[model samples]
Target: MITVVGTGTGAPLSPDAGAALAGAGLVVGGRRHLAAATTMPDTAERVVLGPLAPALDAIEQYLEKPADQGRVVVLASGDPGFFGIVRALAERFGADRLAVHPGVSSVATAFARLGLTWDDAVVVSAHGRALRTAVNVCRAHPKVAVLTGPGSGPAELGAALRSSGRVLVVASALGAGADSGTGSGASTGTGTGTAPDSGSASQSGERVERVTPAEAAARDWGPAVSVVLCLDESRVLSPVRTIAGPPPGPAQWALDEGEFTHRDSMITKFEVRALALARLGPRLGEHVWDIGAGSGSVAVECARLGAAVTAVEKTLDGVERVRANAAAHGVDVTAVHGAAPTVLSDLPDPDAVFIGGGGRELPAIVTACARRARRSVVVAMAALDRVPAVRDALVAAGLDCDGVLLQSSRLAPLPGDVTRLAATNPVFLLWGVRPPARDEGVAQ
Candidate 1:
């Protein structure tokens, strides 16, 4: 059987792992892990893991030997099962053929160094994945842990979050001497509670440096960086929770018009908002644009649904109303006071967009949003004349357009202790979706 041992998080090798290494016919691990393990017998063939497939092949070769020949052992950083090599090994050589030993994960070590609890933090990996997803997560959530890879390290992350008002805790060289070398192992990134002291070093040679997003972007934090914690200092410590991750999204969405502070009955009705939300599919690690956000109802709801939202309004009072509604709902939304089609140029690309009130510039706004939108775009219009132009704009941008004319009636109390069905105005809700293949190819 192949023995998988977790190491490199300042944890000593367990007796079983040590014995397995000593008796191994073949050993596979990173250079640091192999050098740190002094107990391995001289007869064991060492394969320094650079590319994964080659190492798996070597392990397979060793396994093919008879029972008396010897065993194979693989050393990895932290718990091999938690986004580690165990899955790869198990896929190549069946789980029953391996004995695994786990160690302290870098995420736990980084949070421990900060003297904070992480049961509420969102953890995402930028390892061999698009960095935009991690950036979006950092923008949407108050606390986040990012597992860094080559191109997705601290500098890249910081550059993306420079304007996001987040503090980054860069932890490097976990469980090593003061002069440790760097490797391409797992790096845990997250946001934590308590103000960072900055420039703190642990006895194990782990350097935990705290810097603002701008500062982090300015410097090159070498490959030794094990983890990064992105935090909003204002809301670092959340209330006690029963579940983990992102607080389980909002329990209720498509809030009533009365729930928001709007001027002169100028908010998206709950019925229309519900359908728009369904088409938008806002969630963690996504960005949404609410154009012509009069009362900012749609923007606030998108933020509440766990998406990074930017609300655009032409009037100053409308901008304030958007901000106020967002504050009232306890969510973050970037309220931009400017006309659509023009203001949207500066903002980041959105996964989905909701265009509320664009008058003469409705088609231009829809075209701008649909062209940049990675997934879909939803447009709500009260005037029937704008419907055809909006649909044409969506189609011009290579989107599959679909729409509905909604007419609803709600119960209204009458003077004689009775209720009457009050018919509301009709609205045209139009949405355009990009093809899946095109969405996957989007750079942002």
Candidate 2:
């Protein structure tokens, strides 16, 4: 039988775990975990996990030995089940062959150290994976915990979030290292895994440093960092969540223009926003760019629908307004203070884009957005003369183009209290989707 033991953030092992380690025929774990273990039998074969596959194979081989003599114990950091080695072991040996003893996860420990609750936070792991998605999650959520590894640690995360207005709480080595263990350092079968009353590991030398993104990026946090908590301090304790993680998408999107602060009347109308949002099809894990963000109505609405959104506006006032509007809605929108076409090249490729204002450069902006958008691009234009050029740009980019003129009239109360239709300005909404390669032949 394989027993997977979680070495909680520097906490002393429990008696049951100690006994299991004492009788283990083979112990598998990282170099640190093995070094910290005091009860492992001298006869126990040790496998340091440089790569997980070989260690798993060793466990399988040892388990094949007669049941009378084989007892394999695998040690892992924090809760093995939470983005840990337990899933792999369970998959290889099946759940029936293994028993899991979970310790407190590092995420739990980090939050405990901060004296904060995490039911409202989104937890993501950047360990051995691309940091882009984790970065995007931080941009979209107010509270997030990132599990760090090798290249995807705090420095990388901080550089990506430099202007995002987030604070990084870097917690390094919550529990004492293995070299600090003060037992006989000999294998004993008593299996009493209780920690010392002095609690040296739990109380001393554990570092939890809080820094802004700029501060975090300026220096090395070293490899000892266990986890980083990215928080927007303003929203850190925002109303307790009845549901955990990111709250559900706003009940209704395509919010009214008055809902956002804008310069003059330069904002997408609710009717146009509804259609543009439908075409954009924003969702979780996707990125959407809103060019010429004006009041950032489109960007704010896209974020409300669960997409990581960036708003590009040339004017400083527009950028501030976007930031204000996003904060008002309790959503994160990266407001880029620059014009499109030129600035768009540096931003991450998007799943979708919405061009609300581009002046005379509208067609060029549309071309750039179409080239980068993986899914769709939607453009709203008030000048009728710009529609053909915009459509041509999308078509030249190998996209299927479609559009509609949205003309709406609101019911206004007349002098005698009778209602009359008041016509609003007309807007041309043009949208494009990249046609499948197979459909190109038929279209041609």
Candidate 3:
């Protein structure tokens, strides 16, 4: 059997792990892990993991030996099952053939050091993945723990969140390291892990630093960062939650037009909003844009569906209404007071976009949104003349364009409690989706 040990997070090997290590014929781990393994038998063949495939190959070769020859041991940090090497190993060698031992995750350790409970907090991994998903999650959620990697470390995360009003608690060298000092910035603390003594090598060099997004962006926090906690201090301590990870995408979406505050009854009808939302496909860890958001009905719905939404309005009153609507819905939405095509440049590119109003500038607005949208763009218009231009613009941006003219009639209360079919104004709903191959080519 291959014994997978989780260490490097202040937890020493258990008796079972030690016994397996002693009998290990092939030991696979990182350089630091191998160096710290004073108990590893000298007869064992060591494989320092560089690329994952080669280490997995070595393990496979060693597993072919007879059970009486020796067993295999793979050393990993924290919980091997949590975004670690266990998945890779299990894929190559069946899960039943291996034994996994877990330690406290870096996310858990970081939160523990701060006296914070993380059952309600969202945890995202930026290691070997796009930082945009982590950044977008941080932007939408109140508390999030980001596992840091080489290029997607604290500085990169901070740069993305500088204007997001988030406090970053960067935990560096959570277990053993060369230097045992505090991190740079405000509110620095040094503490040892759960070891018996202060000088224990396994628990030393753990430092936690709290800084603003701007502060975190300004420094080069060398290669020792374990996790970064992005928090909105105001909402750090959330009410006790029965469930975890983003509180389950609002019970219902496509909320009624009356739910939002708008002037002159100007709002996207529920039917159109429903189709727009379907085309947008907003979800957690993604960003969505609502351009010309008069009432922010679409934006609020997108936010309710668990996306980081930005609403751009030309009128100041419209912007205020958008913010108020988002507040009433208990979701986060950034309301920017400016016209579409122009203000969109200042905002980050979104995974999807919704255009509600633009008048004569509808084509230009659609062009801008289509070019920047990573996935899809949905446009709703009352004027039928704008459809051709918008389709042309989407086609110019290399998106597959499709549209439908929606004419719906709702049941209205007539005299004597009788119901009459009231015909609602027809709306043109158009959507453009980027091809999967093309979307993969873009920088996420």
- lDDT, each prediction: 0.85, 0.84, 0.84
Candidate 3 Cα deviation (angstroms), residue 29: 1.2
Candidate 3 per-residue lDDT, tens place, 115-232, comes to: 9899889999999999999999998888999998989988899999987888888887676542111121222355322212222322446668778787777777777688899999
In terms of lDDT, the best-performing candidate is 1
Prediction 1 TM-score vs. true: 0.91
Give one digit per residue, the lDDT tens place, for model 1 in 1-444: 889998887767778887888888888998878887777888888999989989988877777788777788888888889888999998988999879998888788788878888888898889889998899989888888888889998889998888888898888777764111222233333333232322233323566677888777777666677778898878878899899888887889999999999999989999999999999999888999999899999999999889999899999999999989998988888889898898888998999999999899999999999999999999999999999999999999999999999999999999989999999999999999998773667795
TM-score of each: 0.91, 0.84, 0.91
TM-score of 2: 0.84
Model 3 poorest ten-residue lDDT run:
178-187
Worst 10 residues of 1 by lDDT: 178-187
lDDT (tens digit, per residue) of candidate 2 on 1-444 = 788888837566777887888898899988878887778888889999889899999988888898767489999888999999988988888988888888788899889878899998889999998887788888888889999999898888999888888888877766654321323222111111122211232334456778778777766656667788999888888675789887887889888888999878989999999999999998866789999999999999999887899999999999999999998987889899988899998898898999999989999999999998988999999999999999999999988999999999988899987999999999999999987556655856
RMSD after Cα superposition, model 3? 5.2
lDDT (0-100) at residue 379 of candidate 1? Answer: 98
